[model samples]
Target chain A: MNEMIRSLENKPGLSTVGGIDCDLHPASPATKTLLPYLEEYWRETFVMRGVDRLSLAMTSSPSRAPINVRSDWKAESGFAGDTLEAVRTQALDPFGTRLAICNVLHGSMIMHSDDMAAALCGAVNEWLAREWLDREPRLRGSIIVSAQNSDLAVAEIEKRAADHRFVQVLILAQNDEPLGRRRYWPIYEAAARNKLPLCIHAGGSNRHAPTATGWPSYFVESYVAQASIFESQLLSLVAEGVFHKVPDLKVVFAESGFTWLPSFFWRADKTWRGVRAETPWLTEQPSDIVKRHVRFTLHPVDAPDQDALARTLEHIDCDDILLFSTDYPHAQFDGLNALPAAFGETLAKKILIDNPLATYPRIAADFQKEVAK
Target chain B: MNQAVLEKEKNAEAKLGIVDCDIHPAFGTPNELAKFLPQRWRDHLADYGQRSANPLVGTLPYPRMTPGNGMRRDAWPPNGGPPASDLAYLQEQLLDPLGIEYGILQPLAAGSSTLNQDLGAAMCAAVNDWQLDKWTGPEPRLKASISVAQEDAAAAIAEIEARIGDRSFVQIAIPPRTIEPAGRRRYWPIYEAAEHYDMPIGMHSAAFGWHTNSGAGWLNFYIEEHYAFSHSLQSVVTSMVFEGVFERFPKLKLIVVEGGFAWAAPLMWRLDKQWERMRSEVPHVKRPPSEYIRENVWFTTQPIEEPENNRHLLDTLRWVGADRLMFSTDYPHWDFDDPRYAFKVPLSPTERQQIFRENAKQVYRLP
Candidate 1:
């Protein structure tokens, strides 16, 4: 067992200094913690209804799952990433991350009531800004939005567009409907208008089972099945003409493993050739559109070994599509060996720093201002 | 020559033909299948009609892209029947030309995973009987799959028992998109029956299911829905591995047909990694998930993944052992692969033999 682990571990030469971590999960705030951030009317209603006592963490990442918390990183109480101080010392400091994007996975985003979902999502964004972004100089945030109502989702994106710290708009891969439906176009339009990339992370609303064939008995199945969810959503986005409509929209798939991309691209491109007339809006191949408009975060590198990872990267063929991420506090890897050993220094620099800056315009603008100063 | 050299030469000579594992054989006419069903079912088929979970009745909700109901352009027969409906046409178009010594029939009639359990089971039995009487009995090179509605364990087992000792039937055919993940205890009886009979279970990707094709939601275009086949199969593999189906039925063999094999290696890696962290949740999964998959699962190659770089395909094949892949053309389908041109990479003679003929022959115990 020890030998197997050692063989799978990334080679230790890559440096993390000044790298931009694309995906870091800050713990979902308990309802009690978000009371101050919520509007007065909603806050009062929450208190009156006793909703404040509930733990609003999404079920996608169960609190007890060993993969949710590394043994060394757990705090004295609650989840390891619950506090900004813990994140600063444990996630941001260890890797010397110049900028780490925080994607908060709260249950509020998946609520049944559209208005309530909107209200709670707003509060979570406010909480993220005040509690984490205001204190940490090196941290950035993703604006959490509920897609149950597109108007409400667009409003949230517009509200957070002014804040440079929120580099992208975050939505779940599995939602009430496929994210590429025309109903959700308003959200993408708003994202493009603001130059904020859409970040579809690995989690679901629990509206449906994580697998197409209904629910599995264990979290292990659900977690491993996330890659397929990502695949479906990507195909939806491309086939439903979301890219053609929102041409400027740069989509980032965070916490979605990239090893599946090569075969998926092949299948997508091959099928598109035979069925091109079905989606005439797509003038080019699906893989071409994906390569042009989409970027993937690196974590939970699902390859078996260095050689396999290298082959995957080679098959993917585009250097600009992968952005660096620690997937902080999620136990995707141990210590600072987040970047696989297959990457040489040049490719490592591109993935860790260059690709992220190019993907998120807001982050790049902030970097430009800092450079000018 | 020495004895070892003589044996090697003989083995090489014996490995000349191919075992095509995923040949879809359609009924010659709707009434042909109805003839095999009971009179009650035949009346129900005519009166209430054959219903599935999809909204559209008597047609697919998302129409297939290719003409002739998603068949290859040239596959439609001159006798005015749908592609693969006439065995003579199929033999002429695929088997004779591809040099297929043995062809396994996987009928995609949506009989195994439909919402109507009774109708599903009836349709499955009818398809099984039709395969034997119409195709396999007349053609010795062709073999039948014992079709069953997997949601009804008793019905599925009974169907298997009926065909237990028949050499005409090579394996049990189930749908990847079932009422539940293929691994749950609900489906264990069928697995036990397969094990007892020493028959492999073939999970061919089906088009109809109660749930949407994707985890996200119902898809919009045929392309997206077609791509969902791989995702559906991936979930089945994950479920079966983590749910300890293999641990409980160690000798049960699974041949995942039509879904490409490139994704298997990475999925196994991910499963093994997660099992190491979450083994307590599934204590019955005694060994690494990859070990069970490598031992119990076999994958068919059709709609084979065509990576831009041929070396990458070689890497995937190396990771997933060459011996684990069986050559399949998904015959008569729009995305059929010719055995001669499917693989872009140069394979050694041994690897080629294992993939094209030896592996399927061993798994199916074919003559």
Candidate 2:
């Protein structure tokens, strides 16, 4: 109710002006074949938001569409109103940035079929180039590299990283092999070389069960289950020495909650000697390495744990490791103001304003210049 | 950003009395446990001979359960004796100047262990009886959470209704796993019975059930699953809230025990946010979802980050309301990390007392 972050009240004049996850959908035939799930209204004007785009919650379940637009639609086809345009008219008025999609990752895209996956990748990139990239000042993208195809992902990263518009390298949190099990370090190395952050977004575990046992009846369980996927990412990258191999490499635990960050560190730090005693070659306290290289977003806020959150931050050694993100338009319903309400002004400032600026070194320059003044 | 301010509070720990909301007897006495069991089951254990007959111990054979992992088979009632050894330990080691003024004694074999339910229930009954006798005194330093036969809800309710008359017994302790949606009705009898009893329900985490865990290879170990296990309790909260269990049981004051509060903030915000659309599904509550949490739910802090930086933890505490949360030592669950190790997060002394003891005294009706 009361904001604690007065410094944040200053709302650091973001000269960089990039959003963490701005999703966009193309308007052409490519978009039709690709982002077939998007309503016509959602298809248009997504590029007008910001540079960084994160998750793609686009679903064909018209039932899932935001309210108010269901009654008013201009469509010639079955349930065929311009949904994107409708979204543009309603929701997009305030926030229409960029959309991040995987080129041809594990499983499928709009559809789980291979053809759909490939088509979705092309469709999103096309939308970026046409609706964003050169056209939209704020449109940014991630080169979706399929965990199923590391080479294609590597190529995608190399290609997209060369263009300033492509920001992150999006990989599904699930991997064909356990993330910490080596073999996957090449993706890290490539992204490290390209100076791009490797963003591991959850919801992609191909040929793998969502839960260790059975599916949870509720969506909340499924969402919370994503923490395991992140545990895998943190372990795979750090324990396997990806960060050590590629020192400059940066990783973001996209959409996965940050509370696990400290717990993972607390556990991972003890692993080599405790749970991981079997593997002695592992070097360094997992916390030291993680706090240095890993960054994650806090969204779909897990209702805050006043002491635990603070304890975790102390355990990890920073107030800024948790980057502020609102998984906007996703079922999570994280608003731009979610941080302010979840945390007080003191924490809201770090999580929302300063943390992001600190995590992405590329943006740190401008923040430094501002602080200098 | 305010390291100095937080440290200044850290230096002022002299005033904070470490409030441990939950602790256990390591394991209870078999003879005491024999009282709650059906004779057929009681006799099966007695056959072990006077020297070997421990009612509280069914002897689970998991080799990984060491002294440090919170299940010290020795600190509990030894397999062949009365729970005499652990009682000395609880008062001497626990109640002495560890700064812990009050401790909530729960069933030791109940949480995150391979301990079976029959024995778990038998032992829980034993624990309740033993604690009632041991913790009642003028300076009454110990408090007990009534242990029910959770697997058998009928007998569990009967057991609760039987001993709940003891004033020191202020809460019904259920392994967090037992506090589920499907199990809600089965346990409702206990909640209803407790309506006149005037005690809060305490839900502590144990090695009871597993929600799907993380990596397959990773899931094999308890270390990896502990993180996943924390989220499982969220399932219990969702069940209670979304299913209108809280609505049906308006007087239900449920406490989420041993559940770390880190992830709760997001889940609360997201769930409350969902009310924007799903409120029709749960029309019983007149206010925001947080109102329900503050009104009906409370959580305990253990393994809490000492120099907690998430700062959000305090914010969440503020959101949940300090009066709703309780401080727990998890006594010997890594030594409950010492309360002073925590509460160093730079809250005012009033905030510290509320988190440490005063808040618990109110929620748990602790002396």
Candidate 3:
């Protein structure tokens, strides 16, 4: 069995046979590449409005930077993961990703006009569905939406919900406002209604400075600071009473380093004990709410050493809180060993498949259907 | 269960007092600073109040955790004034009852970090005097921080120089949120002054309208704002380290108050990790980031991070170095820590004495 598995792994194609890949990036080739996916009216509108050659890449994660993409992962002339075959060979097949959730992070969230943003989101989703998921059985997609307008975001979610392959909805970690605000509640309502987890990936719309004081001087500061941004978003959701409003909502912080969770949970819970009156909707401790509703992707796995990693996992404690991911072609880690060896087998299986299945009911249901067939 | 253990527990409450490092003393009113200001600034105050970068007038842009605008509900003075105003009331409630030996006062008022430099400096001077007369004068256990409008570097230096030798003042308190990262070369003059005076810079978490509490933008809830305090401290620590503030002033020390210390160890590890990869971008950072943090920075414990298991907290404290941990109450604030119950771990008596009193005494050179 081991010899057969090893031989099959060497084949040049995507596979979700044994494990679930929670995070993978499938780039929208470019604005020009996505033009065919858009309705003709919007396509002409884009050309007439002179919105040609849109860079869709986040400023924080500049596509051209050496740090953004690994040297080995890049294709001959363009960026890695720009094509379906490259994603298959580099991410899915190599990592033995039984199922991979594609988070198409093209800078649609930054669009100033709600209509344009909504239209671009529609285009991105259609592109993912037709170009990636339709062609690849192992691939699943995130429903891209313009969080700037809840009505539009809801509409987008409803439009994409018909496809069971799209298991989650995607939003940038940095947004115009907190994800818990009522303005964004409709999006959550739609996501919850469709059993889709609201996945907050590491990229941002660059709508604001990445830190509290102001724009950081270096890229590393901005990069390291996203975890805090995710923390604020989590606190916002808890404090502004979002979980109470949308009880079934599941959150995935993809590319957010997981080591900060224990301390953050501690601080949040501690503060809630004193200030619970302000946020009356919080019925349980912040950590309790988080453990039940939130799942973190393990990409950065940012701990100083093996002992530190062990300590972080011990603090996290719960088996269901982490999901495995390569964060493919994004230069987070080196080689095929995306899951750190220190994680061990039991936790590895949970992160790779079980936790993800539990988090996304629709995906689990689909997996059941596939097995029966 | 033993008689000696019971006696030690009882004795721990009575005389083993905490040297509370973060006691906020607010003004009874903005008008309290009138005596310290000149006519032009006074007229400006009447017409414009504080022309701060934030929209609100002499208040935080967002409300905080509790009823008395982030103050402990019980901390409100019996005489119908703002909390932290009446010294007699503070002593009666916080100092006397908590068995506070030497509580360092962090006067958070309308001064320092305000836009109008002259008014800010004058109000800071006034706040310092008020700290001396109103809070510390009758209460010998209370110590003062020389408040200054940090933007006006020369004026800030002058203020420090004025109070350089005064034993009544122990440190220079600067707000965590500033126009730039507090370690920018523009702010180095203040560090120079602090080092020359042998005073540690107290960077307390406070709202400055110059920017949102979190860089991603304004947070919705006070809980989020509260969490952002540690995040702000993280930025300040990074700013200090990457900007070579330590290399510049080898003797200078920093005490980050109210922003819990559990994040300190991890942040240092992260900073060091990133510095290794991006060292060329910031060549001035002489040593690994953790080295600068361990040697130069001290963290106050308040709103302490409480993991479900006490062992995790102990491990974190071990990583942060027991000597670097100073016990702070954040007295009169909503989230004040009771030193007796704050630390969940079983600290050795020597560890307790160091964290509670000796560490602070050593840092501030207290007699």
Candidate 4:
């Protein structure tokens, strides 16, 4: 039994050199940090309201939760990715990441007031560009948008589109409504026009319980239920004709574990066959549509062992869907052992370097420009 | 017959007498269910006409894909009644042909956890009585689930108490979509009663509740709505595990019906991983979440996940052990699985017997 368990364990020494990290959560800027980026009136309003003193980080990922910060990665500030230096040395340097995308999980995106959400989201993008992207050559930014108001969200996306450093648009997996509804199509339209892959990360607005049932007592229940949120959004995107409407758009499910994909795809495809009339625009199979337009990041592999991981990947069938990610400083994996040994060399290269470049067009364009230089 | 031929026939007969964990038994007519309801509730049903959490009055919020309310194309009876509503038709279409020796009936129309608590309890009692009177009494091969309004624990417990000694009722049926997550203390009395009565709770995937099908909110299409069934059950399982349901009711067994089982292994892994880091938040959960799931939960396989490669499913079955699976056909539904072809992968004789027959028998405690 001991020998069997040992053999199932992932072998060490799988190097992730030059890998493009697709989902890295840089510490959210405190409301005070964003005051400089916000407009003058809003800035003063924040100070007067005492919001400037608030951390504004997502409650779903409390700083003190051991899952939120690895013991070794935690800094004196009581968080792991609090500063650019911390992110660089702790995440980038260790993984040998060629380029890492920064996803900031600030509470501002989920604010109920559309105007405040938009203002704070815009400030977050600007703060991200100036504070993190401008400082590190290897860093990239995801335009954090308030999904509550698509008009404002699209404006923010358009504002940030000119910056090549910004490669994707970020939104929570759980929002006011399902992301595929026409109410939010303008955001997808803007993302497609700008060639930015929309990254739906795990976390929500608390407009509803994290589960379809009512609220959970423990955070672990909320955390584990994130995968289903991703599933619902994926189905919505396919069923609502988002892919058909915006053919150029790409979707990235970050921190949404990939092991659930196989079963989800099966259920989606099977149900779609019988229910195709309701979704007339879905001319193709749901799984095929997902494979064509969607990509998932690798973190919290969720499989029990190397064999299970390999089997899950095989069930997923498509090799191009997985992009490499560490979900850095969130304690997904220990040390630099981010890529599972089960990925093998060939698949690892696709997940690490090829898939991300293909998913994020700006990154590919930037890499091309760098090569020419 | 020759002695060798007789032996071969005996073995084949034994193997063919498999237990199907999920077989829907619908009412023959609207009056069939009404007959079981108390006259006062019957009058209420006529006046109010079954108020649900869904927005639509008569139709489902998300309409089913297939005709005859998502029934199999051929499931409509020759004499004209809803699919699975006619016992003779059901026997012809599923039980006899599929060799279902013990088919557990899950009545989806119960709406046991609907928002109107009093009406919900009344509907549950009516459905439970209807199941016993119409189905189990006529067909000894068929068994009933004691449907209850789980939100009203006192009423649910009363319903359980009213049916405890009956061998015809094999398990207690609760809707996966409850007013609250099933693990909350408000629902503990029902669990306690289930434990005391030695009845496993069968939480079948349901569509109606106060909550939207998805955690994110109401989805646009039926495909998305159908997909939410698995997610609903996933949350229930997660809620139960983390909230220490198993720790409290150590001997209580849960059989998740209609919801696919392939997601179980991954859910267990995720629960264990989070428990290691966030155990302080749920200290009452004495062991890893996976331990409770392994010890307490049984998964029914219907609408079985058909991956691109069959071997991948075998790997999942291996991870979620063959002992944990029970065969379910979801008969008369559009996405029903044919028992012969449901499992694409090869199973050893022991594994096949366990999944197809013995496991469900043990969980439901059937003769």
Q: Please report the candidate that would top TM-score against the real structure.
A: 1
Compared with the true structure, what per-residue lDDT tens digits does model 1 show for residues B265-348? 878878877888888899998888889888999999988987656667888898899989999999888899888778877777
What is candidate 2's lDDT per residue for B1-367, written digit by digit as tens? Answer: 3443343444455455566787755434335555655686567556742221122344422223345343434334333332323565566556776767777776554511223445555666666766666554433667777777565667677778777777777788775554234224665676676655767877776554333334323343344445445554565676566556667777888888775665455556545554543444456644555567767888887645322244535555655567766777776554254554555456666777687778787877765
Judge candidate 3 at residue A116 and give its lDDT.
84
Clash number for each model: 0, 66, 7, 0
Q: Proportion of native contacts in model 4?
A: 0.73
Computed on C-alpha atoms, the DockQ of candidate 1 is 0.68
Candidate 4 on A280-370: residue-level lDDT in tens?
8889988999999999998877866787778778888899999999898898776787887998999999999999989999999988998
Ranking by TM-score: 1, 4, 3, 2
Arrange candidates by lDDT, highest first: which order? Answer: 1, 4, 3, 2
Better of 3 and 4 by DockQ: 4
Per-residue lDDT for A156-243 in model 3, tens only? Answer: 9998999999999999888888777888899999999999999998768777667776666777677777878888888888777788
> Once superposed on the true structure, which residue ranges of model 3 sit more than 4 Å away at CA?
A1-17, A48-50, A76-78, B1-17, B28-30, B61-67, B76-81, B96-99, B137-140
On lDDT, the stronger of 2 and 3 is 3
Winner of 1 and 3 under DockQ = 1
Candidates 2 and 4 compared by TM-score, better number: 4
- For candidate 4, lDDT tens digit of each residue in B249-334? 99999999998898888887777777776777888988877778888999999879877666677778888899999999998898
Give one digit per residue, the lDDT tens place, for model 2 in A243-305.
767898888777666655654554355334444443344567767777788777765444333
lDDT by residue (B155-197, candidate 3, tens digit) is 9999988877678899998887877877788889999888987
- What's the ranking of the predictions by DockQ, best on top? 1, 4, 3, 2
Reference-based lDDT, residue B160, model 1: 93
Q: Looking at candidate 4, what is the lDDT of residue A29? A: 75
- CAPRI grade of model 3: acceptable
